[model samples]
Target: MKPLPPTLRENRRYLLLRITPATLEADERELYFAVSDAVTALFGDTIAAEVHTATIVREGEYLILRCRRGREDTLCTAIATIRSVNGTPVHLTTISTSGTIKALRRGIRAERKGNSIICTINEAERTGILYADEKIDLIRRDMKGQDVVFLTKDDMEIFHATTTITDGI
Candidate 1:
């Protein structure tokens, strides 16, 4: 069979997801299933197939999901509904979506060093605080038990103080 031409190839996007409950095992298959179920339940099999999610990478607390280019919004919606994987309560936070993997990696790296950060309290609800332009002090060596998650600009705004963002959500 002849391979399709470059122009005919499908455009894809890579999404970076930050996983919470960091203690849970990082199993690619389980992560894929949780994502698959969320999309299938929300949009049915037709849209689910159209999305074509692929779990490309799983680091300590990060997951790189690949999906059809234009379906990023759909993917994000599905991701938001996910509550658990393999009965382990978890949170999936969408960091970014990029058409190229190189760009996606760069964004994730920037996040690791980015000035904004979210500090999560060690509790059942896992309360979090979104801070602007600051991170180093919160994660200092003396603060041995701190749980922090780096976030993107969008996330920063979403999790920002409600008292300040009085504008319509």
Candidate 2:
């Protein structure tokens, strides 16, 4: 067989970390830390610096971590955006109101859209209600025959979706 490319090899190694769920919360935290540490150890200080922006998502019993490391220009713009928003009451108010309206519309649309759609659950997943980019709205879980109301909104869209948790390691 031909040798795998370097990127594929690296991705394969990364995929190895996705395994079965731990029984304890501490174990889960430890696993997350270990994954963060491993990324730093394998990719050096640059990768380590970007780890803070990473998010660990939990869907049902599975855990996944998503990392986004940007280039210099992207990082600079992000920093600038953060700094610009600091202590700016008017700007903050405008952003907040716009975001809230967008989220409300998305929720309403999602509710009217579909039911029981399949979703891939990685380590960085979030359950209950999810508001995305102040636009798209997705409801992650809905159990049947149970009084479990995962999402509720008077003027929001609600869509049904299923989450599939897979073992990696």
Top model number, TM-score: 1
lDDT (CA) for every model shown? 0.70, 0.31
Compose the digit string of candidate 2's lDDT tens values, residues 30-125.
Answer: 544554554455556785565443324433223333334233232223322221111111110101111122342222222222223223234334
Clashing pairs in model 1, backbone N/Cα/C closer than 3 A: none
TM-score (all chains, Cα) for each model:
0.63, 0.26
Q: Which candidate is the best by lDDT?
A: 1
Backbone clash total, candidate 1: 0
Q: Least accurate stretch of 10 residues (summed lDDT) in model 1?
A: 160-169
**Model 2's TM-score against the true structure:** 0.26
- Give the CA lDDT, 0 to 100, for residue 3 in model 2: 100
